[model samples]
Target: MVQNLSTLQLLLIVGGGIAYTVGIPVLVKRRPDPWPKTFGYHEIWHVITVVAATMHFTAVSDVLA
Candidate 1:
């Protein structure tokens, strides 16, 4: 219904925002070579958490309503 659609929209917005925030900085500017590579590990962890949170949020939201 409307609520499910809203949840999905919210998820997409939030996820895309996060990806943009993390991706732009790494790609646009360059300071050190190993720095971006090293930092990418942290970014990957963030991505995994975001995905997990999205899945968990959707499941819980569906169950609640």
Candidate 2:
């Protein structure tokens, strides 16, 4: 199945996976202090998640279309 993927598609999928794997642990381990008062780890995690999802979506759409 992987052999069918174009290089760009493979890269996007792998990159997204890597982002999620890296981001979640960092988000957990370095949670912000004063949890209600500042823009911090959670916000950064959300952005990373969005970017990762976008990368995954791009890859899936390219493959499906």
Indicate the worst ten consecutive residues by lDDT in candidate 1: 25-34
lDDT of 1: 0.57
What tens-digit string does per-residue lDDT give for candidate 2 at 1-65?
Answer: 89999999999999999999878875887655235356677877887899999999999999999
TM-score of 1: 0.42
Clashing pairs in 1: none
Using Cα atoms with residue i matched to residue i, what is each candidate's TM-score against the true structure? 0.42, 0.84
Per-residue lDDT tens digits for candidate 1, residues 1-65, read 44655666566556655755665554455322345556654455455557656655665565578
Off by over 4 Å in 1: 1-39
Q: Which candidate number has the best lDDT?
A: 2
